[model samples]
Target: MKAVTGLGWGALILTLALAPLLAVDLILIYLLEDTPFRILSTLAMLGCFYLLSTILSLFVDALTGALRSFVHSNIPRLIDTILHGTVSGISLYVVLTLFPSIDLSTLTVMAIVFVHLFGASFWLNRENSKEDVPLELDSIDQQIIHLLRTETIVSCVERIQHDYPNLPKRDILKRVKRISQSNKVTEPFHGR
Candidate 1:
């Protein structure tokens, strides 16, 4: 629990720390260029792009989660990040390609920057989600799952945290989510 919390806090602080740098970079890019209006326009456009990315990410996460239900596996954090980045890149590229009178000299660099940003944010989100994992649960430990299945989410999560402090929360949570959704495990719960 502490390990997952610490990682989550670190990632949040790191993101807060990066926000100013992103703003500064945009400002510098604007200053180096001759047109001030382009800077403002670019900034607004980027803001819209980010909002789009946020919406797309939520949609993708839900979609991926649903897809994983059938496969009995969650999307790995790294793969999720890359997929979001790819989706964002394609949208930005399409907009750039279609915009008239705008020179796209910086489009490639901007795509790279956006990908890094999205990947970092997704990494942080993935880490934060580890708070509920029960990574150390073994097949033999299924004995106690009787109690866990009856416990509140918070209680069950805390017990798992306390009992398996060294385990990976992501792995634990992934397994728990799978176990909850699976008829194989839930049948007993339903019968009870």
Candidate 2:
């Protein structure tokens, strides 16, 4: 939990830091090339892209975690890798924009980088999902489980003794037979 909290904080800091750096880089590129506000728009677009991706991943993970009640899965790890690669790529693009010319060849290189990184992330995600889960128990939880078990066992024993004073444990464990039948019950319907 602490590690996750720390990572979340780190991402926030990176995003915050990247915004101004992107802006500065874009501005410098625009100045050198004598371009217009298109660079600012590009920066904003990149920011929104990362922001949307981050939100979507977090929301998906939250929903999945709520449903499954566990995080040991490839899906979350894939989300993390994509986020990491995106941050790295964004930073690299900002730094590289300072060059005199960002030729088509350079962009091809960036595209290749994206594909390779995403592919590796995909493989890691697959491998992570294939892992066997270890069976481990927490002492505190185990203690609580034992207490619940004892309480339920004691209740059943007392109930049987009250119902059958002399019957053996096997005979005391008779089927629960209702003394009287009751009318059918209905819930207030919420119509579809």
Candidate 3:
């Protein structure tokens, strides 16, 4: 039942994400003349937009901090939204520049930017709200940290999975990494 609900929600989210892209494609079809390269150019523009936006988003996330941190504060969420919108908008510009035949008006560009901003904010809020991990480390977290001192993260993750089948590997890795970072800050370094 849970899996089914998750699947339904996933489908809805996917549809929402693709909505802007499809809208642009429709607009392009209407605006562009029926040239031999129309279809080919349209497909290329779509591919470039997706590829460039995705790559830019990753870099933006790294620079601004993990989008998941939105769960902790609305500030990160707001920052992420702005950055995402900028990246998407820039990607659109690059694509349009590459394919000069596919010309979009200022109004269209603004509309796409607006959609990107809203979609990014909405998506981040929804995703962050779904998972609420405790800030404080538990015994299991301590064990993971201890193992990290002597074992590889992969090994620690494998051991954790073997011992706690219900625990998520991603969450475990996150906890271990966060705890390790905090420990580094709190502990003093001794220089030889």
Candidate 4:
């Protein structure tokens, strides 16, 4: 359910970000032919583009996640921006190539870049700040700690996610690390 919601949001955001280009394409298609058949064709083309872009967005999301895990550290803002721009630009180019009739104008390109830059900066800042938020020892934290005592952090996170679908997995992992470290420090005699 959560994954579906996230995918839906991803599609909506992709649609909004691509709106200008899509509008231009629609107008160009209509101008090429004023008949009802042309209008229907234009709509069909737009639908195909939307579906393609959404799938591409999901691919980008998964790629980003994989890259993030491999790095094992927060990506700098500059690097993050470059990564997003390069990926999005390539995705846009691929999508445009599929429908060769659509002309890529400067204004459409600018709008897409501007939107992508804004979203990337906003997301990076929000992600970086997640670590700063204090984690209280609520029921969830307690559950995380309990699992951490007998399980690896990865398994603990998976269990917590299964039980609490809405909670952020990163936060749960952070809590597990914190609690385990604190336990090691406060109960030094147990290790010996």
How many backbone collisions does model 1 have? 4
Q: Can you give the TM-score per candidate against the true fold?
A: 0.48, 0.30, 0.51, 0.44
CA error at residue 56 for candidate 1, angstroms = 1.8
Where does candidate 1 clash, by residue pair?
133-172, 133-173, 134-172, 135-172
Tell me the spans in candidate 4 whose CA falls farther than 4 Å from its real position.
1-54, 138-192
Scored against the true structure, residue 109 in model 4 reaches a CA lDDT of 48
The 10-residue segment of model 2 with minimum total lDDT is 175-184
Which model, 2 or 4, shows the larger TM-score?
Answer: 4
Sort by lDDT, top down from the best: 3, 4, 1, 2
> So what's the TM-score on candidate 2?
0.30
Candidate 1 lDDT over 1-50, as tens digits, reads 99999999997986686577457546645555555446656655555555
Report lDDT (Cα) of residue 173, candidate 3: 76
List runs of model 1 lying over 4 Å from the truth.
1-37, 97-101, 106-125, 128-192
Task: Note the Cα lDDT for every prediction shown.
Answer: 0.61, 0.49, 0.73, 0.65
Better structure of 3 and 4 per lDDT: 3
Model 4 TM-score is 0.44
Q: What lDDT is reached at residue 25 by model 4?
A: 56
Question: Across residues 64-140, which tens digit of lDDT does each residue of candidate 4 receive?
Answer: 77787898765566776666666666655666677666555656545555565666667777976896676566898
Clashes of 2: 0
> 71 in model 2: Cα distance from truth in Å?
11
lDDT of 3 at 67: 41
Model 4: ten consecutive residues of lowest lDDT: 183-192
